[model samples]
Target: MAPMNIFDNTETAFQLKSDSELERAYFLFKMISMEPLVKIGSAVTKFALNVNLPVEGLIRSTVFDHFCGGVNERDCMGTVDRLHDVGVSSVLDFSVEGKEEDAQFDATANKVIELTLLSKNMEAMPFCVFKPTGFGRFKIYQKITENQALTENDKEEWKSIESRYDKVSKTAHASGIRLLIDAEESWMQDAADELCEKMMEKYNVDRPIVFNTLQCYRWDRLEYLKKLHQRAKAKGYKLGFKIVRGAYMEKENDRAIEKGYKSPICESKKATDDNFNEVLAYILNNLDDIELFIGTHNEYSSYLAMELMEQKGISKSDDRVWFGQLFGMSDHISFNLGAIGYNVAKYIPFGPVKDVMPYLIRRAEENTSVAGQTSRELTLLKKEKQRRKL
Candidate 1:
């Protein structure tokens, strides 16, 4: 049978969810499927939180609980242990977003360092993740990407950013944890890529300790990967990447049209899928030199990966390859693959309720935007609900 057929086993897919938890997930995806509801709900949630309405509990009990591991590391321990029991690993992602102050950057960096140290002793938690903008100002990265000359203050800020990157990456290397540095907007990604490559060179000597993300929705990423691979081979270091179909397509396209430049995103979803598959194949083919973390929610893509690995006689449990999805979504893929001895992980986001709202809201909005994703989630969840006679 095809690998995708395994995903139909909802019994294994949602083995961890209680009947009530399953119902909540079904309802959440139902809400997410309605685009207008998502928009209105997002605005209302933001307003309620802004006016200091006592809605954190409600938020925490609903979307926050379903999508995130917990509000802090201690709060997430139960989740870590539970996932580990089923052979799925966790990457504790600090999902707080939109902060720009230097102090906040330092705090985020320190949090990553703390998580790296914590993950060193936890079998379930194998990866630590943080956004590039989480460590510094987005404008500074934008300035660097645009090749604009920075003032002394900007240079100082850039230095501080580099220091944060080095500090976190060095800690991860020492702890023997793989650090996944997330990609952001196209304009700022160039600087992040350069910084991640620097970390890879410094720490990936013995193995891949630092992984950069490639948003394959962008037409240029495959070529960029090829070029980066050549550079890493020449420099005597391994390259690690977490490849995704990207998250900022609408924003990227809108910004390109507004600024009179070509859009970085592919022309259509088909093109993005093709590019993602191509990049996946490229990394799999060169597994000796490149370690891959396949971060996707599409079933076909996941099945294609499994097929390719089998065709090449690669072990299903290869350390160089991993499959990842978000914490709440795509349990079918995560759990089913884990059941079969694949290296699978869920990106478990955790932060304060208020701080993680932006990330949660984006996840909802992105779900609504991605054609068929929310509906597919709803369908699988409903199937599970029916199967359990709930």
Candidate 2:
């Protein structure tokens, strides 16, 4: 039989979308392609939601429908099933942002554990994700990283944070579900990294039950990956790496400039891509002690990963390697790769419309910042729609 070509089958890629859904997606990307409009529209949407204007329906049917799985987990079930039909797994993410109170922390932690419990025996939902700040305050992390001494009360608070993480990770491990600790900004990352390592030490004895997201756009991540693997090997644990090209590039640059320090990010996209691919190769070489999830929208990176797998003679369905993209974007990469019997999953973030505005704004900004991303989505979508009419 001929070798599977992978990632040119738009028919399977768009099988999940209807004619109207396809039109809406095309229109959405076309609008997002206009950078200025996305910025202005994001600001307008934020304002409208701030004062409790009645725009939920408008927002829900447009961008929310296009990007998010739904307003809640129950609302996301249909999307989960559709993705399963096409052989793609779902990594359900709670997309709500910006909560700081302790009660809020417990609530978010409960919801995350709830998500893990819900996916316990489900094949369609193979993984679940949680942001560190979702379960605890970000300032606490910032303070902890600043090397400041903690007071008696501060010590108690730190204990609470640890408990929260323990609860979530333990629940995921117990439920036989793999969990990802999403990466934050460089400033707050020290704590997230430490926590992930600790959890890996605990639950990753037999297999990788927890994963840490590594953003390769940062200049030091290649070295960081090396150090992480060294520690994992010395400590006798499996390290799960969900590697991406980094999301907060512009923000990282602005902060570094303001703070008068060299940027942590790479100077150019090529450098970031180079670092990413190199680290990925390193992971494949160490698959005995590592598992990898290549989370990228870059087609060449995807091709490179497949090539590496062939060179290494690893089975396409090897549990040690997987591919992931966010929901609603990169359909060609996700669905086409999945259809070819490779392990592929998409991050399907779901939450209330108003609460998820931050995520929506970031999605808009990402499409604008990443050159050709929006246009690429538009091109593949147009191809599929045209092919559909035949």
lDDT of 2 by residue, 136-213 (tens): 778877777776787897778778888888888899899988888899898888877887889899999989989999
Quote model 1's TM-score.
0.99
True-vs-predicted CA distance for residue 247, candidate 1, Å = 0.8
What's the lDDT for all of these models?
0.94, 0.89
- Lowest lDDT sum, 10 consecutive residues, model 1, at 1-10
How many pairs of residues in model 2 come into backbone collision? 0
TM-score of each: 0.99, 0.97
State how far residue 139 of model 1 sits from its true place (Å).
0.3
Kindly report which residue pairs in candidate 1 clash with one another.
none
Error of 1 at 18 (Å): 0.6
**Which pairs of residues clash in candidate 2, taking residues 3 or more apart in a chain or in different chains?**
none
RMSD (CA, angstroms), candidate 2: 1.5
Expressed as tens digits, the lDDT of each residue in 1-390 for candidate 1 is 345598888999999999999999999999898999999999999999999999999999999999999999888889888988999999999998999899999999999999999999988988999999999989999999989999999999999999999999999999999999999999998988888988999999989999999999999999999999999999999989999998888899999999999899999999999999999999999999999999999999999999999999999998999999999999999999999999999999999999999999999999999999888888899898898896
Off by over 4 Å in 1: none
